[model samples]
Target: MNRESGRYKGKRIIQGGRTQVRTVLYMAMMSAMQSNPIFKATYQRLLEAGKPKKVAIIACVRKMVVILNSMLRDGTMWDENMAKN
Candidate 1:
C-alpha cells in the first residue's frame, strides 16, 4: 500500500521490474485474449464475474506470465490440455 498525505492507498503492483518485459507480456496478453481459447475464456470469465476491464486484463497478464514460466521451466510445448490441469 502507498501512503501519501495521510491517506492510505490500495496495494499496487511494484514498479521495479523490467518495464520492457512487462510491456511485451501485456501486449502478448492482449493478442492472446483474442486468438487463444484458453486466454479468451479466462478473460471472459473474469469479466462475467464482475471484475473491471483493466483488472481482468491484468489478471490475464499474471496468468500468461505463470503459464510462460512453467512452460520454460519444464521445456514443454504449448498444450491446451496441459493448461487445463
Candidate 2:
C-alpha cells in the first residue's frame, strides 16, 4: 500500500479490483464488525496501536478475504476462532 502525507499520512485508495467484489467485501467487513468477534477484536487492536481508521478496517477486510479463500480451498466451514492467526 502506498501512503501519502499531506497533513496526515493516509493510505492511497486501492485501485484495479472488481468493483462488485470490492463492494461485497466492504459490506462484509462492516457486517463482520457486528457479527464476528475476531474481526472486531482485530480492528480494535489495530486502532489502539495507532493505525488510521481506514487502514484498520482494510486490514480486517484483507484478513477476511484471506480466511475466506482458505476456507474455500479447504472445502471447510469457517471456525470463528480459526482466523486468529
Candidate 3:
C-alpha cells in the first residue's frame, strides 16, 4: 500500500507469489530475450522507451506465460508469426 506523505512512499511488487515459479520465469525470460526474436524485439522496444531492464524482462515473462497458456489451451504449435499477431 502507498503511504502518502511518508518517507517510505514508493511503488513495490506484492510479494505473494511462488518464488520457484518466479525464478524459473526469470531464467526463461533471460534466455528468451537473447534467443527469441519476438521477446528480443519487445525488450529492445521497452529499453528504447526508457523502462527499467528488470521491468522489461518481467513484461516479456508475462507475455510468454500468456502465450504458453493459450497454446496449451488450443493445442496449437508455437509459431513466430502467430505470436507476432
Best by TM-score: 3
Per-residue C-alpha lDDT of model 1 across residues 7-77, encoded as one tens digit per residue: 65665554777889878878888999999999999999999999988779889999877887999999999
* Greater-TM-score candidate between 2 and 3: 3
Better candidate by lDDT, 1 or 3: 3
TM-score, candidate number 1: 0.77
* Residue 25, candidate 1: C-alpha displacement in angstroms: 1.0
TM-score of each: 0.77, 0.80, 0.86
Off by over 4 Å in 1: 1-16
Candidate 2: stretches off by over 4 Å = 1-11
lDDT string, candidate 2, 1-85, tens digits:
5676677787577888788988888888999888889999999999999998888988999999899899999999988767888
Model 3 bad stretches (over 4 Å):
1-9
What is the alpha-carbon lDDT for the whole of candidate 1?
A: 0.84
The residue pairs in collision within model 1 are: none
Model 2: ten consecutive residues of lowest lDDT: 1-10
lDDT tens digits by residue: candidate 3, 1-85: 3445756667656376798999999999999888899999999999999998888999899899999999999999999987885
